[model samples]
Target: MVARYLVSPHGGRRAHPDISSALRAAAARRRPARIEIAPGRYEETLTVRGEVELTAAEGPGSVVVGRTRGSALDSFGSVRVHGLTLVGREADAVGCHTGTLTLDHSEIRAHGGVALHARPHTSVTLRDSVLAHGRALFTGGTGLVERCRFTDAADNAVAVLEGARVSVRNSRIEDSRIHGLRVSDAHAEVIGCELTGTGKAALMADARARLTVADCVITAVHAEGIMFIEQSRGTVDHTRVTGARHGIGAASGADPVVRGCVLTDCRDTGINVQTEARGRFEDCQVLNSGNIAVFSTDGGAPEVHGCRVVGGNVGVAVIGGARGRFTHLVVEDLTNTALRVFDEAGAAFAHVRVERCSSGLEVRGNGGTTAEVSDAVFRDVEMAAVAIGGQSRVTLKDVTADGGVLGFGVADEAQLRVTDSTVTAVSGAGAGALGSGRLIARNLTVTGSGSLGVYGTGSAYVDLARSEFTDCATAGASFDEEAGGQVVDCAVNGTRGVAVAGNGRVDTVRLRTSLKVVRHAEKPAGPPPQIINIFNGPVFNGPVRDIQVAWGNENVVQNRGENVRNENENEADAEADTGADAETGTDAETDTDTDTDTEGNGSRS
Candidate 1:
């Protein structure tokens, strides 16, 4: 049982040449031990209790356990080393406790401290190894590192603490001058690894650590290239992060479940879930980022699905009191606002698509912020394609903004609710309710606007009902008189001049409309715009009560040209002494067409 313990008879007689007298003559001959060392330097201070086999033949200076002042292999029992080289400086180059530290094709270089020093319930195994410039390599216990290589670690190059349990496969953690894999109340399994230049955070699992990263490739991290803070929970799959500052970072109350990741460039905010963290990101790809590419703030509740963001500079920024759920997203080409909801944040995005964005979707905040979008699309937007200002609140369904310049902008004191929308080819104002704003739309459609395709002025409140406005160059629903709105059963064909314009003091109100000369001469036996210009801007039959029609008995609603203009003439004896409903003097007016509905499509002025 002697395959060269360097010229035999070590525990069978007495023959010891260096290696600390052949490990004290194989620990006073208490059994199992085999040492076949050939070519050189073993200034070793080795000490093993039970079984040990330190074999070597050529390679890595052929068996050098150098100048150790303390630990250069001080296992309290079972140890196996094949092709050894523990070039220690002043300490630890392997020191397991109730030991089992196996290393094949070994090498533990420049160890000034910990280069494999497992403690409680020790167990360390590495194949094709290299744990360089150490300060760490399994500090607490149980482990396995295959195809290993952990470089320049002055501290933390694989450190699993307390309740330790580690497993790393196809490894390569490079240039770590600090933290390149540190799991806290431990349990980590990184597969197909490659983490580069970590001066911190190139995979850090905090407190209640339980990490499982799969198919990883993390590059150039100076911080946060996958970090989960306290209360940390598991799972991150198919990861790929580059140039980190924050490429996948979850904070304090962490609860992770990320999948299919690919985060790029990032100098800040590339997928960061905050404080009360609770994450769940799927099919991620956050690119270019120099700021804000998905950031859920303070009170986090992150849940992003089917994500994709390209060229970030504010593409998804939910602030402080965050609560999120971004679904089926694709936020592209952003240099600014592409969903930047402010403070008291509460989010919900479904089936989103925002392209070539400069400003598409921004719900302001004075706290109370809220945003909800469904089946969205904002294309080639260059500012204000959905911007609801301070005191925020926005809700949209089936939203679409094509080639926008300004479509849908509600001002300070904000609140907007749109349903079944479409804002096409806008140059400006295809739906805008100014300061003190409040807009409630239903079945909206605004096409090719160069101005005023739905505009309500200051002290605003616009309620567009069953809307549709086309080719507007001037007005297709313009309001003033300290704007207060109500445009019902709307329809404006091609506008170039006043198609439903209401001026000072009329407080803007319309019912069952179809003007602009009956949609430009196509079938105009005209008789449906009932009250001249049907409540078009500028004095709707003024004198106080203001343009409230549908009480026909004398039929004098004008404007067939030829200079005819009567506009709400006395309203059927002033609404038959208030009995109302002469078409609609306002009994809340029902049937504009089909199944009765005067209010409740959504209201809150």
Candidate 2:
């Protein structure tokens, strides 16, 4: 039915009174019916049952369908509407009934209720159209929305659910009272879209939904910018988000991958991966966050690498039995702790640098917690830097803590192995060990402290070997009653008080005291216990040094602490090349921070 009708105001000669009647009579066209109506307001409930094209008789934006009681159109077959304005009240403008609906250069303005809704297996397409002041499109099938504008929508701009596949490209949605784009048990692809002033998350995927958002900009979201929860998975690529509560979040077994995104000025955590979820964040820059910049918690293990987090209250906090790995990170200028791990959680940090924070690197666990850390550098912290407590067995290697009030503190039942490290406390002390903890500081240098270099109390054992301490106000190192240690080949200078004071047996051989010369400390009166060089206060009373003395060239004499020693003149002379390298050799700084009750050999039950 190739028909043309003129409206009342536009010179009507042979015209239909209503668009619905014209559409019904024209449905018998072999090809799609083409009915051109003049530009005017028509009042009817149009129910289309066949393929038809209802075009404007004059031009675009001139045909109007107004004063509708229910939906303007109920489509059961393919319907294409061009250059039309549909204004409805208390009902949807277009309801698709198991058919395809296409709108071009159109506008749907509803007072109350949805603008367009498609049932199961029904699709909808909007090209250069606007849906405003309504609960916008709900898609249960494939939905394609391009170059559209959705504004002041009371509910979600687009809801994709029930196994639908939706694509929205080059669109803009603003001031949505609910979520801007919501997907549940569906898949959605949003590209080159801008969403702003959303009351909820700009994009939300839940209940096995798989979503991908690329080259999008979202701002002023009251909730998270992007959310993947309830076993959903998504990817956000090259997106920019600002002024949201949370920038991106993955929870409830969701595994989202966020790559090449810039998140700034979030009210809460910038990136939150929680609830046993495993997310990957790569090449992201998160700045000026109100709370934690990156948070991995609730037994989740998120991998964050090559990221920069700056100016948050706390940066990169992993809690709630979570385990994660942070590599090649640069976090700086935080108001509080830069890296915090707590609540039976573990985090491995490699090649991390933290600067200008109140504190840095706090690892805490109550009963069963552990972690491995290596190659970390902290500088210019105001409060204590690197506080480890609460029964956590942490291994730190090649760490440098410089210029802080209290350099490091280990308390409770924590076991910390600080190896190949340097601690410089310009205003305070270095390494406070308390509460029956075990601290092994090997090959470490502590310099320029205003107080004691190492303070240990409450049965804590402080092991020092091949370490150097200088410019101390009080004793170089002090241990209270019941604390024990062995300091071998350590150089200490400028201690105003006693060089070392403790009730435990301390063996100081070739140790430099306040006199700036290497001398043996006079052994205490009690007989030495029975252990050999492993240092258990007094373990070896007999001749502990082995005497298989076949003397050789000094250069070829490779003497390790595990080797049996002999006291021949040439061998003794060869051993005296400061004999410190054996105890100072690098112990392998690698261990898993987990909740299992496994020993050092890493056997899990």
Candidate 3:
């Protein structure tokens, strides 16, 4: 099937001294030639066999192949090289081993080692090519680079060694100093690529490699955006990795699978699996990081779903022999310990959530481990939202911690179970620091706490039911220094509510709630002149608990028409209880202010 044959570098005749001796005498006259090569310097080395074809009379920088010393092209059968602009090369500019070598829209620049060196069963194809100044010792071999663009490559711009299987699509491998994409004992398929200006690892795999990266966009890398060493196996999807120090680096028996990725501005860890590594991250988004965003070690098994670990120094860092499982996760800004379970690790958290954090969770010195935190939500934590040290076994259900200073801190025999939770606005000091414990909280709600909401230090057995504690400054429920706790249908608001000092055993707590006192207007006796409630409780019906004030004489003279005749006799005593539900208590009124008390008058004191 002789379809065409036309070889020229200028005139013909065993082809002249120009055009690489007339394209090496029309490709040694095996006859299927298409060697064009016009416009410029062509130093030498253009070895080809039959079925030859080398074009570029005008495309890339106008057909220039000026390799002053070594290889320009050492292709085999069925070869096709278009739009050429291959300059200085001392080693490999193009060295296909067998057949089918096709490079389109080319420009292979200055090289000491490799620009392209396909060996075993070669079928190299590079499109829209541009492999810049590459310095190498087997830099790029088994190739298939589409929409190619590899800039300033000093070492390892692409090296798919050992039983190679490489395929990079929509490429843009930027300025590399060391490793940009080096798959060892290879198998790679990086799609929609953009391995940014890297100095260290933009992509690297060792021994048992099998990488499958998709929709990629890896940013400025100095260390690792994707690295799997030893027994490697990687898979990153819908990726986006920002300035990296470490975005995903699995060591040893690696198994990485991160989906829907976004690891932002990292300096240390966004995802690091060490030693016998294993990983799985889905729907990920890890923001501003200085340290750990997700780390695991030796016997690892990392599994995180619907993840988001915001501004971090330590968001999710599990140490050696790590094991984890997190669902619907959200670990917020952490300066230290957003969720850190060190050493002999084990973790399992569901519906996990945590907000503005300092220490949302920290179970250090873990052994055997067991943390089954459920339906979690911890907000604005500054100190302790949860801190269990050592021998793990923490089980918290329907957990919710708000504005925390301390929510749960169990030190020694860390074994806890908190059900249906709601710990709101816990202020200042240690609010609930139960060490050496066993707590079972039901329908709990500890609001505006200052000192202790529930503090049992040491040997304990707390079983709180229908709990509710409001605006506390000092003690709400404190089983001080150990032992017993069993409270049902509880409710305590403010100063020294329930304080069982030391050896404890408290039972009866059923206070039916009924107190609405609002009567204060003395004033002119000194300087206490404001008492404004305006509309407190029962108005029509008679559950009127208070508002008592009957002081006679001594310059006591009220104006404003005697304060509307004392609220029209308390609204006719709330219409005598309004028995038939006649919109009961519909006209409440209680106001006694001589002048002003700002904040626009909706004040509660």
lDDT of each: 0.71, 0.73, 0.65
- The lDDT, on a scale of 0 to 1, for candidate 2 is 0.73
User: For model 2, how does the per-residue alpha-carbon lDDT over 1-605 read when each residue is reduced to its tens digit?
Assistant: 44543334444566666787676567655456777777778877677777878788777678778664777778888888898888778888778887898998989887787888877888888899998887555556888899999999888988888898989999999999988999999999999999999999999999999999999999999999999999898889999999999999988899988999999999998999889988899999999999899999888889998999989788988888998899999999987778888889988999999899877877767765666778988899765667777777778898888896666667667888888888886455577666677788888777887655776655677788778877865556655545556677877776354355433344455666643211221222222212211100101011111101000111112132332334452233311112212222211111111111111221110
Query: lDDT tens string, model 3, 292-348?
Result: 888876776778899898886778877666787889999887766678776568788
Which order, best to worst by lDDT?
A: 2, 1, 3
- Comparison by lDDT, 1 against 3, better one: 1
Error of 2 at 558 (Å): 52
Q: Return whichever of 1 and 3 wins on TM-score.
A: 1
**Rank ordering of all candidates by TM-score, starting from the highest:** 2, 1, 3
Candidate 1 lDDT tens digits, 250-340: 8889898999889998898788998898889998899988988889998988999999999968788888888899999999997777887
What's each prediction's TM-score? Answer: 0.44, 0.81, 0.42
- Candidate 1's clash total is 7
Q: How many clashes in candidate 2? A: 8
Q: Highest TM-score among the candidates is held by which one?
A: 2
Question: After TM-score superposition, what is the CA distance of residue 578 in candidate 2 from its true location, in Å?
Answer: 16
